[model samples]
Target chain A: MPTRILKKSWFIKSIFFTSAFIILLIGGITYRNIDDLSKSSELLTQTYRLNVELEQIFSHLKDAETGQRGFLITNDPLYLEPYDAGRENINYSFAELKELSRNNPTLQKNLKDLNVLIDERMDYFQKAFRFSAVGNYNDQNFKENFYKGKKLMDTIRLKIKGMIKSQNDLLKKTQHTYESNLKVTPIFLYMVLLFSLVLMFFAYNKIIRDLKEIKASNEQLEIFKESANQSQIISQHGNWIWDIDTNTFKYSDNLYRLLGEEPQSFESTVENFMKFVHPEDAEKLSREIEKMITNKDLPFVYYRIIQKNGTIRHFKGYGKLHESSDGGKKLLGTITDITDEIDNLRILEDRNLELERNNRELSAFNYVASHDLQEPLRKIQTFLSRLEDKESSKLSEVGLTYIDRIKNASTRMRLLIDDLLQFSRTNRADNVFEVSDINELLESAKQDLAEIISEEDAIINSDKFPKINVIPFQIQQLFLNLISNSLKYKSKDRIPEIHITYSKIKASDDPEILKPKKPYYHKIIFTDNGIGFDNEYAEKIFVLFNRLHNKDEYSGTGIGLSICKKIIENHQGFIFANGKPLVGATFTVYLPIT
Target chain B: MQEDYINIILADDDEDDRLFFTDAFDELRITTNVKTFNDGVYLMDYLNNEESIFPNVLFLDLNMPRKSGLECLKEIKQTDKFKDMAIAIYSTSASEEDIEKTFVMGANIYIKKPNDFKTLKKVLSEVVTINWQYHTNGLNKDNFLLRL
Candidate 1:
């Protein structure tokens, strides 16, 4: 879309510049032609004036010679008066023509030749007049002198006339040029003026069209600005533009709202805007902006603003750069309200804290429920066992039978209670994990059940156990429970053989395993040659109260495997049971080694 | 379980508990001499008294009227005179905290009192036999750590 606008702009701009160039070129050519035509017309007019003056000078010289001949031969002053005036007019006209033609060396040289002929004619007229008056008054001498003077005057008149005629020919040609000019000037002027007017009209029309476009754009800009303001109000985000050259800032009211301020609440300088930013976030935001601006790139900053109401509102400021004529920078862009985003983050944090607290409570509850609930059950078993121990000696046959039954019932009840605890604690995060040496922790747990372990003739062996982060007490309890359970479920005909081994298991990268992923897990596999279950019940055995054999078959708490499952799960891992009915069970526990 | 100077102390926070315990002792016909105190504070005072009798067994209740059983045990265990006393932790609550804390504090045994009166009636029947001190009869002062 923007490319389309650029293409349109390029097309219009080229048209405008091309038309302007064409009009200017044509106007220049017409103007140059008009100047040359006007200069030539003025020169033609001057040449005509010079020709008329030369003709008058030639007539005056002839008149002055006639007056001198008449006065010297007939002695009349009347004819001399007209000649003297004519002579004066000739002298005045000659001086004026000479001064006018002084810069034209060609015209000056021709005029000088005519002037010498006139002077010779005048001297001849004076000599003829003196010879006719005193030396030879005879008709022959008179005729001779008169004729020589007339011949000299005729020669001077002819020379003057020749100059006048040549000037007249030039005048006729110049006048023709003048007439042609007179015809051409108006037509040329009108064509050029009309063409110029037409061009100007087109130019003006184009300018008007451009003005209209600009006006429409301005109107659209106004509407855009208005909508922008409205949008800022609705969304609490304002946009701004800072012209680098003008050093002016413009922004919508939403910008002020984000700052927890009013338009007039603070000074409208960049420094003033930065002042409202939280001090801690300000440095970070400014640093980002500085890095971007110094490199003449756009900058993005997110920070909090302390509003007038003492609430911290988050804002994300973005800046675009514009360089002034002198290469100074101006940051122009928008500041958006990110208070909701910040609030969401805070809520998430609070929820995580709540989850952690709930987890801790659950762990404590699990431990308490197991320890507390087991106490009564243990006491019941101890009493029942004691009663059974003395059944033969202290009780009648019926009483003996009843005591034995009660002992079995109590032992079964103990197993049920343990199963119930496992079932309840399974869904809870009730395990506290810590980095511990598995060997030492296991030894301590074994010490706790020393009497039973030693009496069972059980051989406990293991590889170098991993020192992993896990719940020490829970893991120890798990070992004791499983070992004791294996001993209790030992095949009546076969001696129980237990093997405790540790191996590395591959970790999963399931989407549910968020955050840092542990790529590997250390597993503790406990294989016992005892009364195992069908492979179909492998998963079921880990469930609460999932027992295959009845009370008569084997004495066992169905929750033993379940407890192991729970403990392993608490350590961010899993447990699975693999066994065959009446064979042995292999309980593999996977614990993440941190 | 013995008549030759086998002495035991029974400390309880409740008067009724002491009375009931004394009745049990009488019914058992235990030859061992018994001493009872209502609170750990008085028990501590008695132990510190010039004419105090050192007992082979000490049954200590956690919640007492004055000075808790744990504090009394701490005070007694710090000294060589009462350090060898076979202290059994008795409490109504069988909480993991109580059990762990007692064990961590070097308690010899942790006992939870039965809630039902029927169980309590049968519980005290063979109490003397499992009193722990009797089991370690051959353990002298120096070999006490190896007995339990």
Candidate 2:
């Protein structure tokens, strides 16, 4: 391409050469102008000098001729004084003319001739002065001397004219040469100046064209920079440029705003940026960044940050870091604010939890409706059976016996329904809790079970029970159920005896399904001398409707232990039964110490 | 000669509770004769009598009555003449706050009606055997006499 440009520029080159030639011409013309000025000055000087020399010669000659004529006219020796003075002066002038005529060989020769002529003339004038001094004015001597002087004067005049003509020729030649040179130099200077102007115009146009292209490129870059910044803001993205050599970082305005900062307000350094990150997530972010940096794999980092307002926000930073061969390793990245995305996820999680809670409540409500509703339904069934018996006729004994069984089954179903209702309403009891004396609570509970206590002939004994924080009515129900459970399950051979003992026991600190997560608990024990179930069934004894004895042997709804479990759980504690089958049962309840 | 000890009427709906109360009264052996009724409606029906015996003591169960014990107590207190009758409220609940409110309603004593025979005896002796103010038409200014 460069060769193509060079080849294509031949026309331009011709123009350039033309312009160059013109410039050379102008330079030469300018130099020649100065040369002409010097030459003209020299010419004028020569003319003036020659003129001056000619004037000196002519004046001296005139003085000499006049003096000679005076001497000739006066014929007195005193008049001869002018003649002698003219001779001395003409000699000095003759030498100057010779020196002035050196540049012209012809003038020099003429000057030599004039000098000889003046010498001859001077001699003739002297001879005439001698004649005037010797003869008294005799006609022959006077005529002879006068004629000699005139002839000498005429010859000297001719010589002076010849010298003047020679000098005039030299002056005319010098003037002609100077005028011709003056005419040609101006034309040459004008052509040179025209060419110089053309060359300057071409060079100036080239500079301006290059500058225009450069300016256009700069404008395009400005537009590109502006759009890039706007897009970054809209996308919640920020970019960073680190000058590895300077150990400095520069971040975009979006990064500042993501951390709840104004455009001009935040520091975007990596150190300061780490400060905004959540401490728990910082290590993870850093580790990921480090791994990416070390491996040059350029992995993306998504982590949580705490904004200036103390809200947990999520941020994602993605970019590649490369080693700048220019001398520093720099890491460049883009950050995105993901707070809204994280908040939406949290809301989804909360909604799922709410859904689960609602599902549990709905199922519990259904269980209560089906289990507790049986009592009234069974009563209605029994009444219906009794009414059917009143209308019965022509039935076999077997059929009658089946109807009686149905009535008995309905009666038992009625009792089961009542116990189920009690179980469901346990949490709804409006028992105001206070610092109830456990001693008083136990005594009252024991007294309330009067029929059972007497019928079973259970010898009840007690010890000082620890005061605890509990709902008194609920606890009373708890005691009544447990005491009844013991008496109902009494052994046929063993005497029924119930023992209640209490101490500030440090309960097992482990948390159970319904137990409060506390450090310690108060253990209360109620031991009974009744048929205790096997240890394998100890955990199952607390389930609703879980019974070891048949209804014929021990009359109970089997819901007593379940109620006790609910109350114990409500008190933020737990209860468990421990015993062997046909031996005895020991139920211990743990209550929170606080 | 002693105004034939005041007749105090006791009413309850529960049969076992009534048995427990009667046995307790027998065991305590209080001189004041007590009458019993099945419900507060029956007791109120008797109280409305114009020519009937005015009982000296009335032991009412709160849980009884189609009108409730509070309503009966309100009726008794509103009638100025019967206000002097020593009324005791018997209940299975031992809430102290309930006893406080009953006293504020002009009850003479609040007794926890026991479910156990032994507890009933103790509660009966404590209520019927305790010295109580006997109302007369013109008693002395300092004291209304009570037989301890």
- Interface RMSD, in order shown: 8.0, 12.9
Give the TM-score of each candidate.
0.61, 0.36
CAPRI-wise, candidate 1 is incorrect
DockQ, model 1, C-alpha based: 0.10
- Top candidate when judged by DockQ against the true structure: 1
Query: lDDT tens digits, residues A169-234, model 1?
Result: 765776677667667766766776676667667767766766677778879888988897788888
* Per-residue lDDT of candidate 2, residues A347-399 (tens digit): 99999899978866865785456453552453355345434545567667787
Clashing pairs in 2: none
List candidate 1 stretches off by more than 4 Å.
A1-39, A59-117, A135-394, A411-432, A439-465, A483-519, A523-531, A582-584, B1-6, B13-32, B38-57, B63-68, B74-96, B99-148
- Lowest summed lDDT across 10 adjacent residues in model 2 chain A is found at A506-515
